[model samples]
Target: MTDDTTIEIEEVGGHRVDADRLRDLLTENARIREIFADSDVAGLRVLGPQVPVRDQDGPPFTATVVDATGNVAATVRGDLDRPDAFEVASTAVVPNPTHEELRGALEVLHADERYAPFAGRDDVIVYQPMPPTSDVEQDDGTVVRRITLGIFDPDGSPVHRFVAVDLRDRLVDWDLHGVEHLDDHDCEDHLPVGVGGLPGGDTGLGQVRVRVVKGGQELWSFTVVRPRDSAPTHLGKGSGVELRQVRYRGRLVLWQAHVPILNVLYDDGVTYRDWQNSETQFQAVGSDPVGPGWRVCSGPPATILESGTDVGNFQGVAFWYDDGELQIVSEMQAGWYRYISEWRLRDDGTIQPRFGFAGTRNPRTCMRHQHHVYWRLDFDIEGAGRDIIEQRGLILPGQPVWHRIVRETKRIRSPFAREWRVLDADSGRGYRITPGAADSSADAYGVADLWFLRYRGTELDDGVGVVGGPPSATQVKLDQYLTGESIDRTDVVVWYAGHFLHDEEHPSPHQGHVVGPELRPVRW
Candidate 1:
């Protein structure tokens, strides 16, 4: 018989037995025989009592019993031994049952409501993203440490795998799960790019090489290093790599030269697979942060203007002398356009745009600054039952400026629930403005405006103002005027309110609300 063969045969205590050609004795064909405890058949097999009796090569496993004609009848093992031990030892000797069959049997025998647990739990599953961190040295003392981002379970257990690439050697190592084993010979050279750099530098760029392999065959390849001063190359044999700094929201990041034909940005940590790239187009997904922490907000990558033509997002705005023209852009987009009612002066003798829109008809105000000048315009609006007001102010960063009223409106909307204190931008202090009454029953409301100036080479001053003196009685507490219970990033403005007192026969107009100081932008 072969080592890997299974056949039906006789067995006594798991030993093969062959007694077919011998005698027709009842005990000879018995693969398994049993004698009950203190019973009539206890000493029937006197050779060794409970010991199994059979030929060396046993017949097919079967119980034996003597009949009147001496013909041995093959009974089941259950007929000899008790059901418990017979089932256990026989189960161990046979092939394992199918999983489905075993499960079905378990379900039939142990039918309890709470027998199978974990049937309805779902909150235990969780997914989370990995955050990048600063670099450190590896234990080998040669390779530098890098932060690898990946998903994990809520209990800090790994859910996905990530590859760690060596920036210097251009090696890719796979991190596997379960088995704590390292397989270098079992790895394949699939990619050849890595992220490397110190935190701070002039040119925020890194170096990397891309290997081109076709079906285990080597193709043409190139290596390029990006530095702030030099230009990129076609291969490792270039004049070194040059890179530019990209700053966004005061954070520095590595800038990739946009290839117009491909419209793709390539970095050391980035690969073709990471981006959706075709023959003529490509799109970048939110992958990872690399290079210097700074993001470029100007030049070829981002066209942000300061004092001439406005072209930038909300994070930052700037303008430079491309040829000889001036431009102006702001982080705050113009949301309204109206007539200016008032204007304020800065500490540098520069004029700042501060005013009210066209209600109650405030006059236009103007200011002159060292680098730029501004003019405020206000319109008059008075109807029999209501008065309308509009205001706007314009600033020319340099000499001549093209003014575009990006925003013009008569209604004010805020996302917070707090009474903002209007601060004076020039004085680096807040204004002492009297808050208006929030009377929903009377349909009374208030409005105000604020303006700011950006000095050529300085930051705005930060300060707070104190409210005191005779106006204290008319002034309402900051909490009283709030429309909601929470406030954040809300603008403080000037407000005015009024109510009529009557005895159902008489009428009188009282000074509902009074103004104190104007709201303007100061240093942050």
Candidate 2:
């Protein structure tokens, strides 16, 4: 942690909460014990604490509790300053593995006799397994989660063999294809890691602060996270850089802005977008040459890039404030694919949300792929209510036209013609979104380029980021949320999906590509 970053941890109602404190609070609650009886506490998370809930004055601090066998679930939501307002839900929960939890999972395997051959090795590196090939056969494939790890051969080879460990510390015959030799353990025994808390993960909560000014007036002040604090717990691939409490020009502009749908599709039938399908490491580490050599990024960093406090573990999100536009650059390592979600907020209020794609050494390095990032922009202009989404297009060569979106629906890009804007209906203050030149349109794949829908506390990514068992990309259909909610003069969410094609004839790290949209302030 450095002075360059700002911790988003604020005291609510004179109550300071962390992961442990929240754990203690829930475990002591008589109602929780009654509802989730006879279950071991598997995990606890305080990810979304600031985002306001419906009918709430400010926001609620929410936490998820996953049971030992990963069956039962619990949720506690309360106002930040009010301790008694905590309400608990008894089921339908997913939990992110903490650093210590993953470490414990690995330690459980080491104690078993079948893994005794390499039990004493300190270099026993663990990673989320590359999803089974059978799961990739459908659009709605289920990615199997397991404690897949490799033993580092300290004498010569980096890794000689890899293995999988079930929840009971039993060894299972496993590979990229599928699992076998499980006498009792099924895929349910495979504890889901969300591909987070890998070896490079550091245990702590951190965020970077950004400030942009124009004409002697500060235009923006916000904290940047790889994915913001209240970002619906996006596993790894389905989450991107987010801006929290974004106050623009002295007014709160956005409550949160993040990408919940980040997916990479290969030419072969491989669809990667879940805990089993992604890794949250760095794209580059410790001076890996700005441009050349045997360059690649894998695993977590040796340093804690985000400053402030510690609650859980997150990796690959740091930024150094530039004299020009605030460069809130966010990079996430996803096994072979590296994603950079950058938010360039300039002094002039031009916010360019850019996403870049690079490659690492992997089986599919040369394979053609499409990287889609669906950014859910929560524009709280003036306030959450009285906000509207308008479609901008050109009537003639230079003539412009605007079409106000009234209902929740999906829209396509009209290349250089069509653009979009989200603004306060009462006032004209808003931001216009224009896709980048390199951002290709969505293909025949079952996904739209743009979507506008009414805001809801439960509408974040189909609640599939953290998984109890296997995860489903087919379940990540953002269109499922477009169930005819009115979008006129009310709280709304604008989901802009960016498409980047990795179809270069000679694609490599040297040929890195950046794609996203530029959000310029309109008539603010």
Local distance difference test, each candidate: 0.20, 0.55
Off by over 4 Å in 1: 1-129, 133-136, 139-143, 147-160, 176-524
lDDT of 1 by residue, 1-524 (tens): 12222111111122223323112232332232332212223222111001121122122233222211111122222213223323211110111111232233233322334323322334221111111211234575322322222221223223223333233243333442221212212111111111111111233233333222333432212222222111211000111121122111122211221110000011111101000010010111111123331221233222111112122222211221122111111111110011111112222212122211110100101111000011111100110111111222243356332221112122222222112222222332322222233221111111212221111110101100111112222122222333331211112212222221212123212222111122222231
Model 2: lDDT of residue 359:
40
Model 2 worst lDDT window (10 residues): 182-191
Clashes of 1: 66
lDDT of 2 at 300: 29
CA lDDT of 150 in candidate 1? 23
lDDT of 2 by residue, 89-150 (tens): 77554443445544555676567666676655654434433332112122543223245443
Instruction: Using lDDT, give the best candidate's number.
Output: 2
